[model samples]
Target chain A: MSAARHDGPGTGGDAPTPAPHTDDQPAVPGTGEWRRLSPRTLLVHCGWLGAPLGSLALTALATGGRITAGAWITLAAIAAAFAVVTAAGLVRWARTDFRVTAESLDVRSGLLTRRLRSVPLHRIRTVDLTASPLHRLLGVTVLRAGTAGSGEGSGELSLEALPVVEGERLRGELLARAAAEAVAEDPVLARINWRWLRYAPLTFWVVGGVFVAGGSAYRALHEMGIEPWKLGFVRRAFEEFGNGMLWLTLPAALLAVIALGSVGALVLYVENWWSYRLEWADAGTLRVHRGLLTTRSVTIERARLRGVVLREPLLLRAGGGATVRAVAGGLGNKEENRKRSGLLPPAPRREAVRVAGGTLRTPFPDPEVTGRQIDGDRHLVRHPRAALRRRRTRGLLFAVLPVSALLAGLGAAFTPVLLHAAWIYAVLATPAVLWLARDAYRNLGHQIVGEHLVVRAGTFSRDTLVLRREAVAAWTFTTSPFTRRAGLVTLTAAVAAGEEGYRVPDLAQGAAAGFAATAAPGILDEFLTRPVGHGDRTPST
Target chain B: MSEHAAPLLRPPRHRVDPRARAWWRVQALLTLSGPMLLTALVMAALSVLFFPGALPWLGPLLLVVLVLPAVAYLVVMPRMRYAVHAWELGERAVYAAGGWFWQKRRIAPLSRVQTVDTVRGPIQRRYGLATVTVTTASTAGDIKIAGLSDADAEALSRRIGEVAQDVPGDAA
Candidate 1:
């Protein structure tokens, strides 16, 4: 390992040097020495016991140093379990070793079975270096190398608890193909903007976070055998709150909830994106570095990036802000993808578009030059009127009828008050539902821009996806019985990245086949027949 | 189907084997049997508990209610699916159109195909039918052409596998 450190000769500081460990990469192309993880990996593996021990200590302190016989038994069991886990960890650590060759990364592990898993270097698409607080405390980090063909479960190789510097060096070495052009100063694509914090509260977490926190806290208390509602202070607080004037207290409670949620959202925003930065690290890698407590740094190979999604939740859009997510491959499984794909936090819509454009390497027409309209506002072909009718009908059927009918039925069975409330609710909700449908319909559009197929849809979270035309792997044209009658089809472009499919819903049937044929030229050619000398026109049957 | 100027995705070149309709019916019947039996038992218990006097009339009515939808599904779904399902293996792409209510036509380029598999359920095996699934790199783009004769399915899978092997790139 010491030899590994001094393997490369020092390069001029001003020059854009290859990775510090690049010289070592080709020195021994096929054969490389296997190395074990940091010895502190044992300590990190045993860190799970800290929770039970900490809880026991807390109990002992709270109970005035009294330890029941059961507690003693539990403590003994914990100690025995800890010993077994530590011994197992040691054996596992001793058995497992990984090595990086010029062509591939190979891991050999298992005490009995003896397994060797080799992932080629070219297929490795992303490298994620994550450190929890305990890992940081132990001066180690966990590195996850995601391969291009890897899907949900088996596509990633993880090295647990490596020394921080070693993990960084390994990440650089693994993705060092185009590292020669890496400048001394990497270009910052985007950085955390304080003004964007205002958009944090506009998220669903403003209201949902309060309930989630309360629910989790209540569950935790219940798990500990304490009934929160039965507590004297809790009961008293509720009684006092109920005693206040109805309207005033209701509004005050609502205000308090909003204030608490806003504060929570702000704290979460600050903690999660404390040092958030999106940058072009090397010629072919994009890097995202953020987090305050448990820090994360993820590097995505540029070739694996399929596209960018500009996301605007209804509330966020109303506040003139949006977020950007990378539609990149090998981010990990679905859950990992969600956590790792964020390229920008909620920022001004203009800034989000700029980031998206920068990521895609195609500058969007400037708003000022494009008659003060956003990218989404131009060159988009709207869906037929039937699509709007479909949305309106669905909204009324699924959203309004269910709630109102349930309320009306309950009222009929029990009380007249709910009957009146049902009608009032219906009256209040119908317009809102209709408006949302109209907005969603208006937003439904698609365009085949140069080198990209742009599709914009969704009302709750309007996503304008700019997918690389070359990235599309397949096409799916779907039509329900209703859609068939209305002569509409939903076209989905299936790429390997992001959501796997981006849909242009409720396009006229003729338009859909034409769009698919035009977007990915060769795939649909057999199925489509255009009129002679009418290439400019939409395809005809 | 229509004499219009507008271009639509015409049906693929082939329909599934005719015995597929019968196999589908059997599959549907097998799927519905347990639920129908459970519903019948529940109704019987309800009648005994609270409506013993009305069981004579209510029992038959409940039977009709449960059997009606089951019968419709057993009859209509298979036929509708048979009518809708068509597939083709083009020189460069595999095409499949399927589903009764939500008709879908999928096209995957041979170059992008990751795997080709032929699966046979017990009922399908009894009917000598197999399903050929052509999976592409994209999760949403797998093309399944069901209800082919066993030999046809094997040939299809082998063909896809051979062609995909020759066409190379990381499918993504």
Candidate 2:
């Protein structure tokens, strides 16, 4: 694939750029633009600010106890203690000093013992900035960065409230520079593969939809009086449903459930799609930004990519898709977002595809190769054409088929009341599964490029993984009792630090052996000679 | 020792990790431990209310529930640990060894390290212990080695800082 690199010199892709901040002024211990957010802004996102204190007052009134009394005093003491903490937090805003300068990123704040941390600009992997609803309201964003670590990490942070556009620009700049630096260091392994993002939203949508459905069901039942808040009512409803009257009642109930379920799914689906974008500024640099109600952006450098991972669940495998992440460059204000209930909500699939594709210039070449599989994003492809014997078991459409079968069996058995919504659901599920099957069949491709392997899978919502032979950070071999019995093993490769990712899956035994021999021929030979623990067990992959 | 053991002679697993659920849970606890300890203590207090003399009996139990678990966690598990067969790997990462109850091992490749912090708490200081926290971008969970001496922790922190300069992962 012909590619135009944005940061390559003389390629006219913003190749030469000055440092973001120049040392025009002396940024000493006290003087810097890196000031903490005001307490007013923090309070906007502080969930405990109001209700917690109100509850304490409520108990104070309900107990009919004087503040000076023993139990009341204990409660009051706790209240006072918490109040002091709140006051402390309110005061904390003043003392916090987050500095952004030409050289380093620094945060100096802690109640008892101050913490003064500084990360050089050059070492930065990615810097992520995020804004939650409250944060957006207050015009403040958090800056999170990735640094290398032993186990956890020694990350860099600058949590200063800034405007949305400014945050994005800053994030974009950092990401670009980080990537450029990464390429400068090792162009051979300077591969920026974002193919995993394509499949990320699908899982997000399905899981979010399920939760919305379940939560809506709970709410509707509670509201309907069929299942009241009172345990007695719930018990009665369950009892009634288990018996004769359920046939008639279930149809109505199922109708209401389906209605609520669709609404909830719709809300989650739309919510996840808002403001989602990720940019691989360059090789080692990446930027993740998204949100509708709240916008967030974070940038990471290549040096910070701890490992690369590829993940394929049974569902994704059926669809021949995978999700890859570059771990945690502190989630680009994810903590604060979570605090505001604005966690990694789903982004629109179109948005995901656009940004994911933009960052990834190529796709994997081969559709399927059965061998020692990498976990997370890398593909251990299993193609239908290679099968000497092919069998289409119920596994692909297990959920839909089983439900449909049960609907045919139990729906027929119990006068068809239970089949109402469940039947419709089964019907809907079958089509969805079939679509997924077709998508999976079409999305298969993989290739080994000059020792830098690029594996692409998924027909629609395709996921492409680029693995630089040089940048294979770590590899782990896992075998279980079941895997041993089946002559299979799972090999996990970790890449791009921060993202909790690994490419792992079960491989046919011969494939595993062959994979071990050929994948970095020298590495496997070393492993064979090395006294690596011989594990013999079949794993439940 | 067998020649096969050369590259395999890694440092012990980090005292502070399990990249899966164990890591997630411990991370959840560690991040919130200082504030949440009171809630656990309150629950423990309620449990002991069964007997008037139960207060004394419950102290150890509370320690077990509240403090010891955290300590044990600080003594076991890790996403990775680092040791060297030679110096080609550089000082970017270091080797940390811990865990006995259930043997765990790891290798913290310095390139993946996000940040290095020396953390000290009241209990930690009282016991003359400090922790070396290593953040990484590759793994969501941060790996840490706790209970080192203040000097050791500082030295480790410095070593990590220096090494990370030379060999950060792809981002560097």
Candidate 3:
């Protein structure tokens, strides 16, 4: 393929101008023709090779001796592997080229066998730009284009490294073309507020991060042929901390772990959401730009957004804080779903609601007011008391009593210590289970207000989904033998956004049917028209 | 019956074609007979090879246990499924209701349907039967109404396609 270079001062131009290709090309300029990735990609690729070499050097220092012949051979092998990998990356960079035409974005790559991906401009749903610290140091960023399709692998196209300015211009041009309507200038919806960091530790990420760190450390020690518990320092530390009070020490150690986890959560939150900003870009799209060490910029068109989900984890809810997530299609692949779904980090519940109202304006338009008016907690219809009884019985039978009986049976069969402990465990665990069941029951609610169908449920992580009633494609009503006896049915509204369907479980059967019929008019009418088993037949045409 | 909201009781009223019961039995027999026959043969071989002198009656007893279930499944269940399987193409939606134990009632709006296809297997072809599948944007909204006559299946597919096309907006 012929490479056409654009000759000009690359910066300060509104549109990229085509330049003449020199016989001895020095620097590549921005143009509509196929262009290679920034050469700094080689440096980024080489950084991956540094870990093994650094570890080897550390091992030599720790041993404090002359390297063995085997060590020399391994070193040589590592060097050879690095060289091979670096050469591959270099060839890949050289081969990779992309062009943004008026209608589509074309990317051509692959060394041995060529592959060209052309994504039409209309189908381009999201253009995301990300830059790690190393990339930022090299003045380059990674750009990804997400298209509307199923399957995680084929939905997105990415260019690994491009000069930061070119990446920005490309993103602007693609978004401008994708949204035909003239976009209004940037109108800020939300920005970083340091006070929101308190909600960071409220997430399960803190506990999960601690567990991951501990697991990784144990794995590292195991790989080195060391039993971590057998280490003298560890044993001494545990003994000294315990001070002959094992129960107290257990709680103390847990507190220490939680404290460390909280710190880690804070650091991670700062890194990921340092400069978080949500704004309406031009006229018809929303843009989210955030991150400290690895910055990210995501732009999504207004038309693709279906609804909004306001999430409140148990702890965050207790503090009156919530997070906002967009229920939009064509934003990202399934793998990036969780990251791309987020619209606002944990903030005051009111702020989250306000931001959600702003983001969902296009989908749920209200003429009387500047901001969309969504139903608040007062409008929610709580499930009946029988639903609470169902949840309580479920929790008692499934979670609490089974474990208690097993422990008690084991204690009676074998150990006296466990026999006394069993009663305490049962008593303590029963209350916790009951409390959670009550919390879940309290959280269960569904409401249809204006043009939206709002459903809220969950104990640990409450989600209030505000979906446009018009978007609902189907309704599924399911009942089990027990649920039928209790006069309850589970109703699910199938939509094309996040989760594909949202279920409101254990509603009074009549109420659920009425709700389903009302939410999507006439869809559920035939089922309600006549009782089943009438032996009636509507003959095929 | 007094006018009241219908209780979430039984499956829907519209049943599939009556001939479906016979077709299902034949299909089940064709699909399951090979595995059942192979199992009996394997037991016979094992009796001869591994436990040559042990209880000869044990082999026959085991064979009875295995073949009895297969016989019942191939003979009885299909008829029950045929009784339960029902579908209705309503003015605005396609309703499908059925399942042996866990009865499912699904209503997919015509506006959401993306594709409709009529399929006929080899056995179905011989029996002049076909199945029509309705696919919608939501994966769970997919519906299959099987055991229709070939003519009915084609008609239903075309009707669904027409209805889906007539709807103005795409599913969210």
Q: What's the alpha carbon RMSD for model 3?
A: 6.7
- For TM-score, candidate 2 versus 3, the one ahead is 3
What tens digits encode model 1's per-residue C-alpha lDDT throughout A1-541?
Answer: 3355324344232212226345445443213778778888999988999877776776677567887786789799999999999999998999998898888899998999999999998888998999998998998889999988648958899998687777776776687754546544536889998989999888746877898999998886664445889999999999998887888998888899999999999898888888899988876788899988788888888888989888999999999999999999888877999999999988899999999988887775222112121335356777788999999999999999999999999999999999999999999999999999998988887877778888888999998888888888889999898998998999999988877888999987777887787788778777665544343322211
**Per-residue lDDT of candidate 3, residues A412-483 (tens digit):** 999977777778877887888889999898778777767787788898898888888877878887767688
Off by over 4 Å in 1: A1-31, A182-186, A365-377, A530-541, B1-6, B41-52, B60-64, B166-170
lDDT of 3 by residue, B81-158 (tens): 776678777777888766544556788888788888889888788788888888776655677888888877888788
Ranking by DockQ: 1, 3, 2
TM-score of each: 0.91, 0.51, 0.81
Q: Of the candidates shown, which would achieve the greatest TM-score relative to the real structure?
A: 1
Comparing only chain B with the true structure, the TM-scores of all models are 0.84, 0.48, 0.80
Q: Which residue pairs collide in model 3, if any?
A: A6-A19, A7-A19, A183-A282, A183-A283, A184-A282, A184-A283
Candidate 1 vs candidate 3: the DockQ winner is 1
Give lDDT tens digits, candidate 2, residues A381-481.
55333221111123234666777777678877886776785678776776666666655544443334545454445433454455555454444444444
Q: What DockQ, on C-alphas, does every prediction get?
A: 0.45, 0.08, 0.29
Cα lDDT for residue B17, model 2?
A: 18
Which window of ten consecutive residues has the lowest lDDT sum in model 3 chain A? Answer: A364-373
Tell me the interface RMSD of model 3, in angstroms: 5.3
